[model samples]
Target: MSGSLTAIALDAVLEEHGLTLQQLAALCAVDHDWVSRHIEEGLLTPSQHGGEWRFSSATLLRVRRIANIERQFEALPELAALVADMQEEIDDLRRRLRRAGLE
Candidate 1:
């Protein structure tokens, strides 16, 4: 261990519009089928254009969170999605608090 560990920064391409289903699966370390199942279950949303599903950063982030929740607790995908929803709300509230100079 070191006195202070340096943070390792990762830079992503950050698709402005969105990422392809394959790209999002790679980013979330999940199989494409798993992503499709979640999407079908209404856990993840992807924009449909030209017969392809495109995922935005927000969607990608939620995918990672839901995957983590599912793995950590062996929970169902719907349960994981519920937890992710609460987390997103908390993050939004935190941002609002920061903007109001209360956090």
Candidate 2:
């Protein structure tokens, strides 16, 4: 229920992706607990309401990226999340730079 993941936007993304918790776990090759822990720790957010967890494409990408970072370097979850956050920021900046013809 935080960040820029508005329910309306998520609904639109969900309509396209239609991914469930299990699907996300399978795609990321991780388990349910991993995703749950990330959500509980505020590293990820679920839908604004619902007993089930519905994921968007962005969530899938983020989970895989964070999991890969943690496995590859044996990094802690917090560190991995931090790295993911920085990477997202860098990507956003790059997009802005490209739009401004400065990339």
Candidate 3:
């Protein structure tokens, strides 16, 4: 009984129907205003229909990354965005490396 704890990983299947602003806020553990601020800062993108906003799984992932950086490092929104940008670039490189059999 001396092994490290193991956690189950779920392959979350985001609803193809898309998520609303409130749903996104709940997932990100932030308030509506926080999400709005990110959107205003040009960090998060949303699609509007009939004056309501909707987000996709990719946006959810990006918001989670931005929120983590902001909370963990106390980074400003812009700084967190910069970090997210670099992280995305690293992710792209890793994907390329894997494609090239270098990873």
* lDDT, candidate 3, 1-103, per-residue tens: 2232221111133434467899999998999999999999898889875688988777887899999999999999999988988898999899999999999
Q: In TM-score terms, which candidate is top?
A: 1
- Tell me which of candidates 2 and 3 scores higher on TM-score: 2
> How many residue pairs clash in each candidate at the backbone level?
0, 0, 0
Using lDDT as the measure, the top candidate is 1
Instruction: Please provide TM-scores, in order, for all candidate models, with all chains considered together.
Output: 0.84, 0.79, 0.79
lDDT (10s digit) by residue, model 1, range 1-103: 3433321111133444578888899989999999999988989889886899988778888999999999999999999999999999999999999999999
lDDT by residue for model 2 over 1-103, one digit each (tens)? 6656686686687766568888889989999999999999999876642567778767777898899999999998989999998988998899999999997
Residue ranges of candidate 1 with Cα displaced over 4 Å? 1-15
TM-score of 3: 0.79
Quick one: how many clashes does candidate 1 have?
0
lDDT of model 3, residue 53: 91
Candidates sorted by lDDT, best first: 1, 2, 3
After TM-score superposition, the amount by which residue 8's alpha carbon in candidate 2 deviates from its true location, in angstroms, is 18
User: Weakest 10 consecutive residues, lDDT, candidate 1?
Assistant: 3-12
In model 1, residue pairs whose N, Cα or C atoms come closer than 3 Å (at least 3 residues apart or on different chains), thus clashing, are none
